[model samples]
Target: MNKAQVVEAVVLAKKAKQLTWESIASTLGMSTVWVTSACLGMNSMPEQAAEKLCELLELPSEAKSVLMEYPTKAWSPAIPQDPLIYRLYEVVGVYGDTLKEVIQEKFGDGIMSAIDFSMEVEKQPDPKGDRVVITMNGKFLPYKAW
Candidate 1:
């Protein structure tokens, strides 16, 4: 199976089993975000983890191989149309400059490394409405003057 097929199989199996990403991550001894990203074909799964996931999902052996393959990590340049996705894009559009300035001030001239990053999503209870909290932790790579 290819990456897209593997992703489809995984999603279908997960839904059929009524399994949450957190549960799958717990079973695999990995973070929820990382596990979900791997399953969604955004990241490559390690050999053992791929085998475990395939076994858990009752997927074909081909899926395990596909899952272990590194992804191209490409996306469309067009603006997203989905409401939730568009909102995130909007946030970056509005605050990207401010974020760059603040981060540069604190961390100097460099960028965050998505290759060595982790993220978590949490829910915060409030009287009026629930709050969504997203925490992203990425290693800061400072520019080296050569």
Candidate 2:
């Protein structure tokens, strides 16, 4: 089966089994963000992770192989259609520079490493409305100079 098919299968199994993404990630001993990304075909899992996923999801042999294969990062040029996704993109567009400047000021000539990052989605109680708190922690790597 194709990668997309595998994702569909896993999603179906998850639904059938009434499994939550958080639970799946916890069982895999990984972060929900990372595990969900891998299950959705955006990332590759190591062999053990893949095997565990296969067991948890009851994935076929083809899916196991597909899960371990490196993924091709592909996306449409058009802006995201989903409101939440578009809003996140807009936030980056508006605050990317300010964030960069502040990070540089605080940490030095460096950038946040997305490769070595962890993210969490939290719910904060608020008087008016509950706030969706997204926390991103990444390593800061300064530019190497000769």
Candidate 3:
């Protein structure tokens, strides 16, 4: 089966089993974000992890190998259409330069490495309104200059 089908099966199984990403990650002995991304086809899991996840989900045999295969990551829209996604796009449009400048100032001439990145999303309770908090940590890759 293709990665998309595998992801579909994973989602179905997750819902059917009422399993949290944290729980699955614990089973795989990995991070929640990485495990979730792997299941969603953005990253590849190791063979052992893939087998364990497939067994946990009771997925088709084809799913195990697919889950361990490297993925070619791409997004459909150049500019996102969904409201939440578009909001993130807008945030980049508005603060991209400021963020880049600050990051460079702090870290030197370097870029964040998505390949070695981790992200966490949390909900903060507030009296008037709850807040969505996102934290991203990544290795910094500096330019190789002569």
Task: Give the candidate number with the greatest lDDT.
Answer: 1
For each candidate in turn, the TM-score is: 0.97, 0.91, 0.91
Range of the 10 consecutive residues with the lowest summed lDDT in candidate 1: 1-10
Point to the candidate with the largest TM-score: 1
Estimate, for each residue in 89-131, the C-alpha lDDT of model 3 and write its tens digit. Answer: 9998999999899999999998999988899878899999999
How does residue 59 of candidate 2 score in lDDT? 84
The TM-score measured for candidate 3 stands at 0.91
Q: Sort by TM-score, best first.
A: 1, 3, 2
Q: On residues 56-128, what C-alpha lDDT tens digit does candidate 2 reach at each position?
A: 9888877898998899878888999899999999999999999999999999998999789889988899999
- In terms of TM-score, how similar is model 1 to the real structure? 0.97
Q: Which is superior by lDDT, 1 or 2? A: 1
lDDT of 3 at 82: 88
Which is the winner by lDDT between candidate 1 and candidate 3?
Answer: 1
Error of 1 at 39 (Å): 0.3
**Candidate 3: which pairs clash?**
none
Residue 86 alpha-carbon offset, candidate 3, angstroms: 1.9
lDDT against the true structure, each candidate: 0.95, 0.92, 0.93
Query: What is the lDDT, from 0 to 100, of the residue 146 in candidate 3?
Result: 96
The segments of candidate 2 whose C-alpha lies over 4 angstroms from its true place after superposition are none
Residue pairs with backbone atoms closer than 3 Å in model 1 (clashes): none
